[model samples]
Target: MKLKNIVISAVAALTLGSTLAEVGVGSKATVDAASINSTAQTYSYVGTSYLYKILKAAGITYNKFYKDNKITYRKGKPEGIVVHETADSGATAYNEAIFFNREWSNISAYVHAFVDDKQVIQMMTTKYGVWGAGAIANKRFIQVELAEVSTRAKFAKSVNNDAIYIARLLHQWNLKPNDAHYDGSGTIWSHYAVSKYLGGTDHTDPVGYFSKWGYTFSQFYQLIKYYYNLQGATTNTSSASSSSSKTSSSSKASSSSKASSSSKASSSSKTSASSSTSSNSTQAAKATVVKKTLKHNAYIYTSTGKRTKTLKRAGTTFTVTGTKTIKGRKYYHVGSNKYVVASNIDGTLRTLKHNAYVYDTVGFRKGTTVLKKGKRVRTYGGRVKIGKKYYYQTSVSTFVKAGNF
Candidate 1:
């Protein structure tokens, strides 16, 4: 019986060895299979997030930076950074800086820094917090706005600059890197997160903006972590480069060049020192008159560009009493002191191919209201990419698939 058991064991071992020899454990087929799986995992983000491409593109860009002394936070120090995206799709960081610097009081919004593909313009110091997210977030977070761009490479570069900037700020504040969680526990918070958990504002930015490029906040958090974990990556504010003095010089030169550009509107010389006083006298002189229907919900602002309490719905017709330019964009005067963006009126007509649902600017369904098939509608005259699809703006906070029309 023992000899028979030994004979069976030897036969089983020989069979296993024969099977291994036939398959060849380290054969070309096995190596190829492993290589394909690894490649699949590595390039999974190719068409979507561009994370793989960004990870290999460059180390860190030496961006143009500027600093200013502004109002300090109520807590004397910021606990984290709030990420924001400029609502305007075409505005650069310098362009945004010019507008915010000129109209912070009127708009009641200001951020510490604005980042674009080409530069990082620090409008104010991180030691101070600006009225960016809301009362609560403003007091606790250093706000930074990422300007939207047109191309993939540019977007990659812009985000690289943005992540590096966030990392540097976190390093400067001695705050550890953390992704914002449901409970509002983290050193990195998005404007959307702030609105969701800390509610002083209603803007859901960066999230929608990132979706347009197939990017997500999670990927951004990963990038932030990448920079934060580097050995000497974020040791100083001038960590954009090794030479602090050179960085300062370049920043000043870049800002001065922007100021000298004629394409940029001359920022309002009149400052709003007192909220009670208005800056209408410095506003653009009235030019033309026209009447049009609002294509999207329009916010009525004072003649001095201060947003008022009024919101006009789409499909409402109004007489544009006059026209004026603010920060180089046209505004239609609807009343003695009321104004709205001129583009908000004068929409492009379309006929619905199917029943359409209205979506918000961030691609969220506004309500149950649906436009029936064959119905004629007007769009805000441009297509906005929300997620991977294009939508036509029917109103502020309302959109429908462009294909549906």
Candidate 2:
């Protein structure tokens, strides 16, 4: 069978922050899965599964090494996530990442990331699409592959990593978690769901794999919802805090109201509250979006300063919303929990020393766009090595020889 190409840190802080907020909100995080006595119903959706509980407690460790491909979604943003299984019961996430990174073009299969018992290794940016599923599904959803594991504990850990990572991605993109329904109008999807509903491929993965452990896609969705709700809880807390502040300020003015007139004041206050909320929304629209060009090969990072993947070669441009200092190094804040070092970019201007042929990621000639000798064009930072020769990346897929510059 042809293998299917598959498809945080600020997320960690958000997880922790939400956990703390739940305490104040009178909500309790689920108990650890190990404490629950095992039963046939342990993995069912009637209640929180033992696996879900344990994953919530163990948390997730995120690692990213972006593959060279930079294909964006057809709509420029993914709508949801597709879950898959490697079917190769013995492969690890790292092993799969290595194999696919090299053979993706040859096999014509690639995914956004892979999940195993230990960590979630994201090889591609979810902001873009991969050739994992059929053309339709690839253009719409982010894809993830779960590595098959033998041991039960390892399986549990892998599922935990999978759910946590998916939940974070969903939250990052401001999307909701929904089961893949028959009408094909949901966010969370399985490869089988895509095969059956979307008609891109015939491979039925994860569904059969989940069956071996008496797990169902519905149950897995519950696990994703568990973490997704936690993220929403934290976000709600922030909104609530702002609301309370406004309420407190308003209450002070009403304190002088005569008790006889309290009824009339109640109606007035409700209208005033509505006006305040609208004003806040208008102010939020002022956030400035800043665009910058890379000066060198720069890594896109998490808010925590952990590197996710190296971006395109220097001189490539990126639009960022803001900037922040992580670990004392200033970083450009790209949306969806991504950051880039401020120093890696200055501008995107380069003068060609000689005429140069633009090559693809794998050294094949990409179309016929050639830079003329002494012509000035914007190029990105870093040298991309194709075979033994290195070239300067001029765009997401275009590269020119360093000798020509």
Candidate 3:
């Protein structure tokens, strides 16, 4: 019986493996699979989550990433990676991307990435479940393809790349290296392991192929864990960088770059140092204008809306009165009837202002876009009113304040 077992194992060692989520995990592509991650790669991410934005920002792209709106989006907190083998030795990673991008592939399969000796290509996103493994396995794992090469050396390189790439993904999801072996609970696994554990698929893939190079699932797990630990530590560096960026922004705020001369404290040539307290109190008592940041360097006009000797600063705030409309244009009362166009705010979005940005909220969201500073926005028409302030409807969900325009 032992000799028979040995013979069976020897015979099973020769294996080759494939998914364009429907082209399934083991199929040939019409195009060279080698070209998928090369030349122009895929950046197909579905859903409008910030994750997609971040992935794009990080330069992590997938050209073939897609979502079938027909399929009810089943969300999963991916606990681990489910590894698979594209059994075709001739099939390259690029071809998998092409296959996954379509709905007409022969096999109904899906996986996250395809790795070969030359490159690692992602075909889909961790955000969606592809029908690579059986439904059970697909529910909880991010499936990846490790392309089988003709030569052992290339196969080993591909394995190495898979380990590195999967490790990075682990770090991205804040997952640790799971020690559970196919309990359907570990952080990573082979397609065969997940199939066995979860009863997800009938096909026991990658096993025969991995055995060819004396590679074991256990070894791959350990390699990925090693890299995960390395990258998990490096992820903390981004926090340090964010802190540094805050400090830099503060420094710029305090410098002349952000604030102008008029906005500087103790720049008063109008008030004397000696007995200046009474003078300041009298000036304060007479002035009822509200303070605001200079959206740009502009002369502060007198009560007649004429330019005063005082030029408002950029980041440094000055004052404006409440809201008022004049000549069919919305304007803020900077001092008494002395008004500044609401659109001329330092960050004030003038209609068609060069580099003026519109945000997702009155207090904007991340990711800024520049607008043209061409036409002066003097429109008094507004719908969204909060307290004494008015807001223009930028979108159904977003608004820009007239006070801050």
Which candidate's TM-score is highest? Answer: 2
Candidate 3: tens digits of C-alpha lDDT, residues 1-68 = 00111112222232213211212123333122333222111111111122234346667553343444
Question: Taking the tens digit of each residue's C-alpha lDDT, what string does model 2 give over 207-297?
Answer: 5566565455666777677545533331011221111111110000001111010011111111111112331121111125644544335
Q: What is the overall TM-score of model 2 with all chains considered together?
A: 0.44
Better of 2 and 3 by lDDT: 2
Clash totals for all models, in order?
2, 15, 42
Candidate 2 worst ten-residue window by lDDT: 245-254
lDDT of 1 by residue, 171-208 (tens): 66788988882346798987667766887765566666
lDDT of 2 at 197: 77
Q: Residue 266 of model 2: what lDDT?
A: 13
Candidate 2: residue 328 Cα off by (Å): 40
User: What TM-scores do the predictions have?
Assistant: 0.42, 0.44, 0.43
Report the Cα lDDT for residue 69, model 1. Answer: 28
Quote the lDDT for 250 in model 1: 10
Error of 1 at 84 (Å): 0.3
Model 1 lowest lDDT segment of ten: 246-255
Report lDDT (CA) for all predictions. Answer: 0.55, 0.54, 0.44
TM-score of 3: 0.43
